[model samples]
Target: MPPAATTNLGYTPPDGGWGWAVVLGAFISIGFSYAFPKSLTIYFKEIQEYFSISYSEIAWVSSVMLASMYAGGPVSSVLVNRYGSRPVVLVGGVMVSAAMVLASFGTTIMHLYLCIGVIGGLGLAFNLQPALTIIGTYFHVKRPLANGLAMTGSPVVLSTLAPLNQFLFDSFGWRGSFLLLGSIVLNCCVAGALMRPVRKTVQLKPNTEPQEIVETAIVDSRGQLSNVQTDKRKTESQAWLHKFVDVSLFRHRGFLIYLVGNVVMFFGFFAPVVFLAPYAKHQGFDEYSAAYLLSIFALVDMFIRPATGFIGNTKWIRPRIQYFFSFAVAYSGVCHLLCPLAPGYVGLVVYAVFFGLAFGMVSALLFEVLMDLVGAHRFSSAVGLVTIIECGPVLLGPPLSGALVDIFGDYKYMYYACGVFMLVPGIFFFIMHYYNYKKLDEEQRQSLAVEMKTSEEAEQLKTSSDDETDGRTH
Candidate 1:
């Protein structure tokens, strides 16, 4: 818990101080957490050849890694709840590094699956949730920009790791590459070291008598609850669930809208990234040039994420950021739909640039919007719940896209299918949020009117009472 400076004290997020350091920490941990799986796909070809495995089987390595990461959200949240983000992130760095080292000595596919897929994935889960959870503690007013900067880690890391993985594989082969990659990710421990615990202080406003106050016991890492609740009838089951994550967000309308839309959107989200290189290869580009498309995408994505955050933070957009997020998703869908029209490497480069822009917009604003709906206090639980539910689509999206390619015997059809998948959810969010916003506005106005009416009635009663007392005294 944070201490007080003066009696007028409240632990307001010193939104800029050491918080920036925490953001940097989040950047590194989150970067490796997200980018590692995608960049590591560079070794899939060699690993396939060595293991003599088929395409589908090799693909499971990444799919399982992602699924495990997503599925472990609750577990990560539980650990973060019991401990703190610093210790959790530190332990996660060690766990992921160990998983990689263990994977290096694997003789069988199952060994890699156990070591990298489950263990490494859970390790990433630990890194990812803690990083995200810590950001809310340290910022409120500048949260959009803060989240924007933090999410930029994905593109920066992807671009760096793509080429690095290629060079590593060329120099040292798959086994050695995995071993070295383990050492490379120990940098997450350095990030963890920067996660200084936040101490919360409650600001008490003087009143005629003692009054109920709301406060968060721990403000830095996992802000589970802040509001003082008088209702103590919570069941044991609900209390147990709340110990790790708030299950009450399921009843929240805005969270429901965000969750359903995201579940739909993700069906098409990752598939394009997965198939981009293969699509380029199918279009007659060599392997290096084909792989370079990701670098192009990441480069553009890197700049756009921070830019999008800046845009979302502006007065005009920040109030209604959901619409902005919806537009970004729609833009990515349109990019995919038009990708088939690109003829060659130059055209593909243009497609990559636009796709990266749209992807960055969505990624930067994704959790920001969720936090907007549920607020920082419940964000810890909301995230875990959302990811656990999203695991199916995230895991299956790329494979489904691959199946589409197999069915059509052309990559263009897969692109078209993914475009539809994205566009529909984009439209869904736009429509649903439009009504949701209107409903919220109406409710706010009604509540204001009720408060005013009650105040006016109270004033009238006091005035009459004074008049009666004066008449009796006369």
Candidate 2:
């Protein structure tokens, strides 16, 4: 019936119990993964002085860290698929902790780059994808809520760490702060510990798991090919790559649309946040007032994520969560485009409120919608592949937005550019996903028709054979 619904590992998810604990673990891992990079900026000014480097050079530390994390997605996905989330996240905890501890003793900017940027970033990458991927494995029905709750970790951690880093820097200095941070990050290992494998406790269901998309690569069609051994080796290598990467997802229409939309969406995604404080100062607001805008945005964002998740999981919205996600992106774009028109600090606060809601809504639904499109079974590969491609935008988007400011000598154009970046993709998602849903319905109906015809033909064949047997007996 219905061409075999794909379930996770032939068992319905527990959807509660240990899954909630796993969400807690994911919350820690994801919180650190996203927050640590932004929070690290607090050390940049002092570190710039310590290393005798330019502001631009100091900035590369954050850039390298973010880039490495995104680039590490494929490797992280492979490990999670092979060994499960617990080991990978635990190792990630150790690696990042080690990175911070080592950075505390570094003698040069290069060492900080290596330890904090590359090593620490990859460790965060390890923490991020596995944590996000595991939630999909453990809950299908409540996944949006789980994801929403898990995503709240980013803003919550960022809000906490921003102020904590300031205090740490004042008390312990950068080196001592790094040392304390190393210890603080040990919580991720505890989080990983909570992520005990789910399958051991889950009750086994019926034996009709859907076929895996990852399969052996097709052999060359010609039997008499001149280099048969070489062809065989090539095929085997392709098969191995397929096992880890799910290259077949390239052919999945919904996955393709989601991936491409994300790529375009991210280019504008974080730019506004980066410039929010600066934009306020440019408009004649005091520095403290400008900083308060970020606090407002983060505060609103923290609440909206869980709310968005709960809404996404509802019966009516769940089927159309993709639309909700698209609208969020478009709404964020509109908020930025209209920012220049705001009257004063009051107007800016209003913009912050709406932008935070839009941003939180998109972040909460991002992975949930991906899993919805590809099924929980294939989400590891789907997310891994998407993040790796998304690295380029996430890394460069802010710099490009800054360039608009450098050229225009005003912030509004940068906001305008970011808005356009988001709006176009939002529209694309709306149109393409609409068509994808339509095609899916048509395909389902055709499949049912074929099933019914085959059933009728089988019944007729059985009846005719029984009549012939009866006549022969007479």
Q: Write the per-residue lDDT of candidate 1 for residues 338-360, one digit (tens) a residue.
A: 99999789999999999989899
**Best candidate, TM-score-wise?**
2
Cα lDDT of model 2 by residue, 234-319, tens digit = 99999999888888999999999998989988999999998999999999999999999999999999999999999888887887
Cα lDDT for residue 298, candidate 2: 98
Model 1 poorest 10 in a row by lDDT = 1-10
The residue-level lDDT of candidate 1 at 224 comes to 37
Lowest lDDT 10-residue stretch of candidate 2: 1-10
Error of model 1, residue 57, in angstroms: 1.7
Query: Model 1: how far is 18 from its true place, Å?
Result: 0.8
> Model 1 scores what on Cα lDDT?
0.87
- Which residues of candidate 1, in runs, are more than 4 Å off? 1-11, 201-236, 453-474
Candidate 2 Cα RMSD after full superposition onto the native fold (Å): 4.2
Task: Please give the TM-score that candidate 2 achieves against the real structure.
Answer: 0.92
**Model 1 lDDT, residue 205, Cα:** 57
- At residue 135, give the lDDT of candidate 2: 91
TM-score of each: 0.88, 0.92
